[model samples]
Every structure is written in C-alpha cells, then in structure tokens.
Target chain A: MKDIILIGSGNVATHLGNSLKKRGFNIVQVWSKHINNAKILANRLDCESTSSIKQLKKADLYILAVKDDAINQIISQLKDITIVHTSGSIDIEVFNHRVSNYGVFYPLQTFNKNVDLDLSKTPICIEANNKKFENKLMNIARELSRNVIQLDSESRRALHIAAVFACNFSNHMYTISEKILSESNLDFRLLLPLINQTVTKLKDHNPSEIQTGPAKRNDKQLIDSHIIGIKDAKFKELYTLISNSIISHNE
Target chain B: MKDIILIGSGNVATHLGNSLKKRGFNIVQVWSKHINNAKILANRLDCESTSSIKQLKKADLYILAVKDDAINQIISQLKDITIVHTSGSIDIEVFNHRVSNYGVFYPLQTFNKNVDLDLSKTPICIEANNKKFENKLMNIARELSRNVIQLDSESRRALHIAAVFACNFSNHMYTISEKILSESNLDFRLLLPLINQTVTKLKDHNPSEIQTGPAKRNDKQLIDSHIIGIKDAKFKELYTLISNSIISHNE
Candidate 1:
C-alpha cells in the first residue's frame, strides 16, 4: 500500500485523507498545530495524530496542506522526504532546500468536511520537480481521479484565479441574492432553480454565449431600475460594476 | 386546442413559443416590429407572421413577450383581448385599458434561444387582474410546469431582483473566470465542476452557510494577494468591495 502522511487537519487535509483512506491507501499519520483537529481526522481515518512536526513518521509521500502563508514555515520544519503541497498559487521552489523531491497536488475543487466529495469527478492538477516524483504523484492521482492534468506553477496560479471568479464570486452572488430576497420577505429558495439552470448551461455552452439579463441586452431602463431596487449601497455598487462589465463584454 | 398568439419574437418569445409548441399548443401567430424576426419564429412554429400590430389576430391567450419598454406600446395597439406580458418587473396595470383579463405570465428563469429550456422544471410566476384570470393562467402554467408559483406584482419584482443576482450576476462571475483563464491560456472548462458544485450547495444549504473564501475566512493576507493578482482595475475594485461585504456579513 502507498504510505501517506497528511500535515494538516483543515478542510482540504481532512477530506483528502478520508478519500485516500477509502481508496485503501495507508494514511500513516495526520499532523496539525491544533491537536483536537488532528485527533478528529486521525480518529476518523484510524491513524495516528500528532501536533509536533518532529513526531511525524517518514512516509512515501508527505502532503503539506497548510495555509498559504504558513507554507514556508512548515517546509522549513519538514525532515526531507518526498513532500508536496496542495496549494494552487504557491511555488514549488519554496521546498527546494528542505526537500529534494517536491511538487504540487492541487485538487481543483472546493472542500468542506460536512459534504461528501467524489474524487473521481474532481480534477487533480499535478506538478513535480522530476519525472520520478511526477509519475509517483500521477499514479496516486490516477487512483483517485479520472481527470488529471499536469499544470505548471503559472497555469496553476491562473487556474486558482479562475476558481476565485467561478466559485468564490459565484457564491457571493448567491449571498447577494439571499440578501435581496430577505429584504422583501421572500424565500431565497424561489431562486434556486434559476441558479441551478445558470450553472447547468456551462455543461454545453460558453458562459458568454449563454449570458442573459438587462446588462447583456443593454436594457438601460431595467438596469437603472435594478440599481434603484438594491437597498444596500455596497451591493448597488457591485451591481453597477458587474452590469458595466457585462455591457463591456457584449460590446 | 388552446390558441396562443405570440406578440413578440425576442428571446423569451421564441423560447416560450417553442416550449408551448412542444407541449401541443396551437401557436397562431408571431408578431414583432422586425418582420424578419417574427417570420423566423413563425416559420419554426409553422404559424403566420405579422410585423404590423394592427394585424394581430384574437386568440385564447396573447403573450406579449416584448421588452419592458415595448409592453405598453404593444398593449396600446391591440384591442380588447386576453393579453399577458412575460415580464417579471412590469405590473399588470400597464394593460388595464387594453385587456380586461390581462395578467403577467412571467417565467421565473433566464432564457437564451440557443440553449434548450426545460420549462417543466422552470417555475412559472402567475399573476392576473382577477380570480378567473388567475385560475385560467394557473391552469395554463400547470400544463407547462409542476412548479407554478402565484406571485403578486411586488413579490414578482422582488423575485426578479433575486433572479438578477442569481442568474445574471452568477453568469458574469463565470465570464470573469473565463477572461482570467483566457489571459493565461488556461482552459475554463476545468472550473465548471467547481461552479456546478457551488450552485448544488444552494439546494440544501443557505448561501451564507455555504460561503467559503479568503473574505469569509477573514484571511487578510490571501485577500491582499488576490487583489494584487487581479490585473484589471475594475476587477480589483470589485474583489475588494465584495470581500469587504463578505467580511461585513460575518460581523
């Protein structure tokens, strides 16, 4: 069995560990600065939990799924093994001195411990310093997912930015919609079908081609009315900015 | 057979016409100021086409699926008939003098002629001047969808604003994602699963509860990095504004 050591107990780490466990991989240990978090995930995976980086057992692969800012500090503490980080924007060179074999294993999907994840459907983006490490990561990734893509640091960063736009910003749009419905004593659930349909269009249509609304149609009257309808100053500003952006794109 | 006269050949008109035809409604005519647009839709429906509003034939239901600005003009031209406008924001009062049984037969979803619409799943928001008309409209809506909702003008307007946020703003975010990916020669297709998952969360979770990002986590360093990474001035401003909004929500 492929031995794996996860160095975080956050959403990504916990979820990935669980997925790997289900795939029959040996999750030897889970490390977290927060002992309770580590214990929770480790107990679930039937593995050991440790707060000290020194206690981390050497394994075939070490995934440092720590926060982006804490990556450098964590790498500095690693005991020189095949190390990888599940970050999209961070460069692999940060681990050059600490670990000879290092790379990125970014799963291009959001992770939440409460939600079930289908790893097979999620895209796994892999990168490594050498062909040997790359092949190792590829084999592990192929075991988990059918969609695996080799992306360099620059492309990974771009993908991360795109993810922010598609996932984070899209969720914020739902947040705004919730606010709009709440103000009017209307159930936000009323807009759920429309939200589902918007995303469904992406399966076969380019977003620009499937785009619809006052902004896309250049309906100034409707756009002006919508701006007036929005009660919050910040939301109104966002509405205007996005409307202008849609208009710019259409033109 | 229910005789349906389409009074506009715009996106909504074309889509609604096609949907009704598939459901076995008798489409008598397609009317538009642009002769070619009306003719094109009419040809597809195997119905007559008319550019002149004065030439409109009386039918069981006259669907005025034109722009909000054109609704009043079209109603003014048509003599007494059972007229309805497929507008979410416009009130039925606009057709009070023109038709005694006027109503709003708003489809509470976005429409694009190029995309296939599943009307059975799309909620039809029905509102009429009286109980009889409401019942008539509700029966018609029942044939098209299982999710028929009775919404007053004010409620429908609120729903429209919410739809704008969910569909229009959500689509704009995808457009932004596409632009960001295109700049770096990355495939936007990779982000589709994430986008779909974000919307799927709305089916069972509240938008605020499902929200995740640097702003939601209050990660100042990540937010700063994201703002710096976005090259466009407007996009950066939007990121900052939305991030602030999400942070404010948590507070």
Candidate 2:
C-alpha cells in the first residue's frame, strides 16, 4: 500500500484524500494552514493533522493541492521529498527545482466537499521528472482511475484551458440562462432537460456538427427578439457578442 | 387517435413526426416544399407524402414546422385549416390572422434528425387565438408530453431567448472547446464528463452557485494563460468576454 501525505485541505485535497483512503492507500497525514480544515479530513481518514508544515511527516507520495499562488511557498517548506501538485497551469518543474523527485497528479474534474467524486472514472493527468517517480505516480493513478493520461506540462496546460471553455465558461453560460429565466419569474427547472440534452449530445456528436440557433441559422427576427428581452446591460452585451460569434462561425 | 399532417421536413418536423408515430398518432401525410424530404419521413411513418400543399388532406391538427421565412406562405396556402406553426418567435396571431382555428405548438427543445428526441418530457409551449383551439392544442400536447406549458407569445419568446443562452450559445462553447482540444491532438471525449457534470450541477444547484474557474476565483494568472493558449482570435475574444462576465457576477 502506498503511503501518501496531502499538503492542503481545499476541495482537491479533501477529495483526493478521501478517494485514496477508499482505494486502500495509507494516508500518512493531511496538513493545511487552517487547522480545523486539515483536522476535518484527517479525522475522517483516521490520520494525523498538522497546521505546521514543520511537523509534516515523511510519506512515499506528497500531493500539494494548495492555491496556484501558494504552490511555491508550500514546496519551499518541504525538504528532499517526492512531491506533486494538483495544478493544471503550474509546471512540474516548479517542484523539480525545489525537490529531489516530483510530478503532477492533476485530476481533470471540478471537486467540492459536498459533491461525491468518483475518482475511478475521472481522468487523472500524471507527469514526473524521473522514471522511478513516474512509474510510482502512474501506478497510484492507475489504482485510483482507469483513465490516467501522461501529459507534458504544456499539454496539461492546454487541457486546463480547454476545461475552462468546456466547464468554467460553460457554467457561466448556464448562470446567464438562470438569470434570464429568473427575471421572467420562471423556474430555471424548465431548462433542465434541454441543458441535460445539450451535454448529452456532446457525448456522441461533435459540438460543431450539432450546433443550432437563430444565430447559427442567421434568423435575425429571433436574434432581435432575444436582444430586446435582456434587461442587464452587461448580459445584453454578452448576448450580442456570442450571437455575433455564432453568426460569424456560420458565415 | 389524432390525425396529424406535418407541413415541413426539417429537423423539428422529422423528429416530431417520428415521435408522434411512435406515440400512435396517425400521421396522415407529410408536406414539404421539397418532395424528396417529405418522402423520406413519410416512408418512415408509412404515411402519404406530397410536395404540393393543394393536395394536403384534412386532419384534426396541421403542424407547420417550416422555416420562419416560409411560414406565412405555407399558412396562406393552407388557409381555412386548423394550422399551427412550431415557432418560438412568431406570434400565434400570425396564424390567427390567416386561419380561424390557429395556434402555436412550439416544442422548447433543440432537435437534430439524427439525435433521439425524448418528447415525453420535453416541454411543449402552447398558445392559441381562442380557448377552444387552445384546449385542442393542449390536449394534443398532453397526449405527447407530460410537461405542457402555457405561455403567451411574449413569454415563449423570452423562453426561446433563454434557450439560445442555455442551449445554443452553450453548445458553441463546446465547439470552441473541441477546437482547442483538436489543436493538441486530444480526443474531445476527455472533456465529455466535465461537460456532463456542468449540466448535472444545474439540476440541483444554481448555475452561479456552482460556477468555478479562474474567472469565478478571479485568478488573473490562470486566466492570462487561458487567453494566451487559445490560438483562434475569435475564441480568444470569446474567452475574454465570458471571463469578464463571470468576474462581474462575482463582484
């Protein structure tokens, strides 16, 4: 069994800790700057918790799941340990310069403490500085997930940007939709099945091939009606921008 | 059994025809401006096909799923018949002005002939000139779906605009994502679960509440990376525009 120490207590850290425990790996400890947050997860895993990185115990694997800005500071505190950061943008070399052996164990999915994450099917992107550490990282990833992808830092960053488009920007569009529906005093629930089907279509068909809209069809009457319906000035601008983009794509 | 005649052979018409046939409606005939297209669906439904609206048979319900530009001409041709067009933008009065027993029977979902449409749960937005015709349209909708919503032309137009935001614009975001992934030689399948989860979150959580990413967190560094990574000029502009919207929402 691999012994792992999680060096943060945010969503990614808690989720990875819980999933690792469920996969029968020995979690050595969980450390967070916030003692309570660290203890919450540590208590669940029956592992020790420490607010001080000085008290951090040695483990076979160390996962740094801190904020993007705090990654360097966290790695500075570690001494000659095999480390990995669950960051999409940060390079693996950030840890390489600071530690003897390092890698990236980035899970390409959004996580929340409230949401039940199934790591088994979630894609884990792994990269290591050395062959030995790479094998160890790959093994751990394989044990936890069937979809382990080895991406160079550049590719991982590219994937991360793609996720921003697919997940983050997509969620913002839903937020706009919710706002639109709410203003009309209609329950956003009315849009759920259509939303579900939109995502479902992406599973089997390319999004470009299945795209439909007044903008895509160049139906100016519907476009004009839509633009007139938006009350928020900023949202109205967004509607016009995206609608124009869709129309541009068709052209 | 309601005898229905389809007056177009587009995605919406074909999908509705197949769905109605499955639900045991006698599709008396399909009339399209294009004879071959009408024949395609008519053969599938084991019904009659005709290019000329002059040869159309009398039916309890006539569905004009034609393009918006062609809607008036089709309705003018089928005057004195109980005709309804499945249009979100056009007023039911457009039909009432031409035909005595006219209404709107708009299905508030995106349709592609290749995709399997689940009509049982798709909300059918109905509007009519009179209560008798309204009841007739409602009865037909009720037989086909459980979620029959009554909206005036104004609300249906609002709902249609919201659908553009939630479905069409959101789909373009997916297309942007697919393009980004294709640049890296990565399969679009990697992003499917993230896309699915984004939609799943909308069912139980408000879209704004479930929003994540650099924009949601105001992570300037990651957002900068994303803007730089997207090579397409238009996509980059879209990224900047959407990220600004998300950040504005948080503020």
TM agreement with the true structure for every prediction: 0.96, 0.97
Q: Using DockQ as the measure, which candidate wins?
A: 2
lDDT, candidate 1, B25-103, per-residue tens? 9999999999999999999999999999889887899999988988877777778888889999997788866568889
Cα RMSDs of all predictions?
1.6, 1.4
- Please write out the lDDT profile of model 2 over residues B84-127, one tens digit for every residue: 88998887777646678888999988888888878888999998
- CA lDDT, every model vs. true structure: 0.87, 0.86
What is the C-alpha lDDT profile of model 1 across A1-251, one tens digit per residue?
Answer: 38999999998998889889888899999999999999999999999999999998979999999888889988877777988899987877878666788999999998888887787888999999999889889988888899998989877877887798788878988888888888878888888878887888888888888888889889999899888878899889888988998898889
lDDT of 2 at B158: 76
Q: Which pairs clash (backbone N, Cα, C closer than 3 Å) in model 2? A: none
Model 2: DockQ against the native? 0.78
**TM-score of each model's B chain?**
0.97, 0.96
Candidate 2 accuracy as lDDT? 0.86
